[model samples]
Target: MAGSIEIAGLGKTYREPVLDGLDLTIGGGVFALLGPNGAGKTTLVSILTTLIRPSTGSAHILGVDVVREPGAVRQLIAATGQNTTLDEYLTGRENLVMFGRLRGLGRRSRGRADELLAQFGLEQAGPRMVSTYSGGMRRRLDLAASLVTQPAVLFLDEPTTGLDPVARRSVWSDVRRLADDGTTVFLTTQTLDEAEALADRIAVLRAGRIVADGTVAELTATVGGQRLVLLDHDGTEVRSIDTDGTAASLDAALGAVPDAERALRATLRSPTLDDAFVALTQSATDHQEAVA
Candidate 1:
C-alpha cells in the first residue's frame, strides 16, 4: 500500500445531512471521484484532506488516523483546491519556492520548482505576479505548489475547472506524470471524459454517498444497456433504427432487409462510462427527492 485511503461510515451535515454512511477504500495509483455539483464530492475531499472533521466514522490516510493524528495525515497528503489562492503580489516562482520552504525542504534544491514551471509551460510566466497570470496558468501554478513536497497522496478538486482545452490538456499531462511517479491521486471532476481517460478506477458520489464504484468499464457495464451496432459497409447516405431495442425486434428488422446483407454487419458492445454517470446521477437525484 504505497498510499491508502479508507473511509467507513463517513457522514457530514450542515443544516442537512450531506453524507450517509459513505464508505471507500483505495491504495496507491490514480483514482477518480466522479460526481455532479452538490453531490458532496467537495465535502468528502475536505474531510479526507483533514480540513474538517467528519460528523461520524473514521478516515485513514497512509494508515494514519485523520481525526486522531491530523498532522501526520497532512504530512502524507497535499490538496489543490478548486480555488487557486496564490498571492497576487508574488511571482509564480516565488510562490512555489515559498511553499517548498514551508514544507521544510529549505536545504533541498528548488531546481525541481524550476523544472515544474517549465513542465507546466509556465516558464515565461514564472516571474509574473499571480494577478497577471491567466486562469489556466494560475491553476497550473497552484498544482505546482502542491507537488513541492512530493506527497504520498494528492487530492485534486476539479483541477481543470476553469481552463481552456490546451491548458487543461497540459494539466492532465502533469496529473498522469504524478501518478506515474507513484503518487496516489484522488480526483473529482464533472467531466466524465476526463475521468475515463485518466482514472484506473472511478467512484461515483451522489448525496455524499458512493452510489457506484468500479473501473470505468465495470461501472458502465452495471447500468449500461447492451449496445447493438450495425455496420453498413455500403456507406449508406441515410440510416436509422427503432428506439426500442430487443433481440426479436432487431432480428425482424434484419430479416426484412435481407437483400442488404452484403452491406450490413451488426455487433453488440457493452455501455460506456458516460452512460454510467448519467444513470448514477439520476438515481441519486431520485434518492434525494425521496429523502426530502
Candidate 2:
C-alpha cells in the first residue's frame, strides 16, 4: 500500500526563509506542487525526502516521522530530482543493476534491472552506454533507476523538463500507471499542462507558503468562473469574458458587445488550470510587492 504525508507548521530558513508554517496533507494519489522559481518547492522536497532538516515543526511520510525516523522514511520513498544523476560511462541496464545492487537486491538484481528497462521502454537501449543516450532516454533511465525497489511513495521534481511532446506523454503514462498501482506520487513541475493532466490534486506554493490547494476545477474557480470566447466573422480576435457558468451570463456578455451580430462563433469554456496558476501566482506576487 502507498503512504500518506502529513506536515504541520513546517518551516525552513537559511539567509532567508524558504518555507514558513507550511501545512499539508497528501494521500495515496498524484499530488503536484506548483510554484515559480524560488517559491521553495525544492526546499520542501528536500526536507520531505530527508535530504535536509526543517528549521521547525514536523513532517511524516507513510506515518513515519521524517525527522525522528529519516531512515525509515527513506526506505519507503524514491526521489528523482531535476538534474540527471546517471553515470555517463555506464549502460542503461548496468545503471539499473547498479542501483538494485546498492539497494541490496542481491541475486535478483539483474532480473529487477531487466524489469525496469522493459517497464520504461528502454529495453532496446539497455545495452547502450548512458553517454550515447538522448536527453529523454537518460531521463527514462534515471526514473527507472529510482524505482529499482518499487517504492511506496515517489517524489519527482521536474521529471519531464526537457522532454519532447511524445516523450513527455510517455512519462505521463508511466506516472499514471504507477499511481493506478497504488503508489503515492508527489511531483513538482513548472508545466501547468502536466499538472492538469497528471495530478489528482495540486498545491500552489508561493512566498514560502501554500497559496492554494485543491482539484483543478476548484482552483480554477477561485480566480473566476468559466469564460466565453468569441471570434469575429473574419476569424480575427474578438474578446474573452469571465463568465458565471450560466447561459444568461454568456448571452449577456455577447449581447453587450456592439459586434455581437457579426460574431462568427462563440464558445463557453471553463477556465484552464494554467489560468488558475497565473491568477493565483500573480495575486501572490502583487500582494508581496504591495507590502514591500
Candidate 3:
C-alpha cells in the first residue's frame, strides 16, 4: 500500500520566500500539486524528494521525517523532475540499468530494464542514445527510470510538459499503472486537464502559498459561482462563466423563464477544467489586472 504524506507549516525561501507556512496532507493514489510558473511548485517537490531542505516546518513521508531522515525519505521516494533526468549520452536501457544498479540491483536489473522499455513502448528505441529520443520519449524514459524499484511515493514534476497528446496519454497510463500498484503519486502540472483527469485531489499554490485545495469538483465549486456551456455533437463543450453565473444562468434562464429547454442534443453541460482553474488559482494580482 502507498504511504501517507503529512506536511505542516512548510516554508522555503530563494532570494524571496517561496513557500510560507504551507500545510498539506496527502494519502492516496494521485495527488496533483498545481501552480503556475514560479509558484514554488518545483521547490515544494524538491523538499519532498530530499533534493533541497525546507527552511521551516516538518514533513513526514511514509513515516520518515524528511528533515531528520532525508536519506530514508529519499529511499522511499522516486522522482522525475520537471526537466529530463535521462543521460543523453547513454541509451535509454542503459539509463534504467544504471539507476537499478544505483539502487543496488545486480545483473538481473538488465532484464527488468528491458521489461520497462517494452512496457513504455520504448523497446524499439531502448538501445539508442537518449540524444536521439523525442521529448515525449524522453519523458516516458524518465518516468520509467523512476519506477525501477517500485518506490512507494513517486514525484513527477510536470511529467507531460512537452509531450504530445498521445504521448501524454501514454505517460498517464503508466502513472495509473503505478498508482494502481499502490504507489502514492505526487504530481505537479500546469495543465488543468491533466490534474482533473488524473489527480485524486489537487492543491493550488500561488505566491508561495496554497490558495486552494480539494478534489477537482470541490475546488471548482468552491471557487466559481457557476458556468454556462454549449456543447457540440462530438461531446465538445465550450463554457463561459462569470461571478454573476451568466454562462450557466443563460442555459437555464430561458428554460426557466419560458419553460423551454434548448434542443442541444448530446452537448456536455459542465464547466471545463480551465474555467475552474482560473477561478481557484487566479490571485488578487489577476483580479486587479483584469484587462483594465
Score every model by TM-score: 0.83, 0.86, 0.84
User: In terms of TM-score, which candidate is stronger, 1 or 2?
Assistant: 2
lDDT winner between 2 and 3, please give it.
Answer: 2
Q: Write the per-residue lDDT of candidate 1 for residues 7-26, one digit (tens) a residue.
A: 88999989998988887889
Q: Which segments of model 2 are wrong by more than 4 Å?
A: 1-3, 228-239, 245-267, 284-292
Q: How does residue 257 of candidate 3 score in lDDT?
A: 29
Per-candidate total of colliding backbone pairs: 0, 0, 3
Over 217-267, each residue of candidate 3 has an lDDT whose tens digit, in order, gives 888776456434434466554323244466555556434322132454323
lDDT of each: 0.81, 0.87, 0.82
Among residues 3 or more apart in sequence or in different chains, the pairs in candidate 1 whose N, CA or C atoms overlap within 3 Å are none
Candidate 2's C-alpha lDDT?
A: 0.87
Best by lDDT: 2
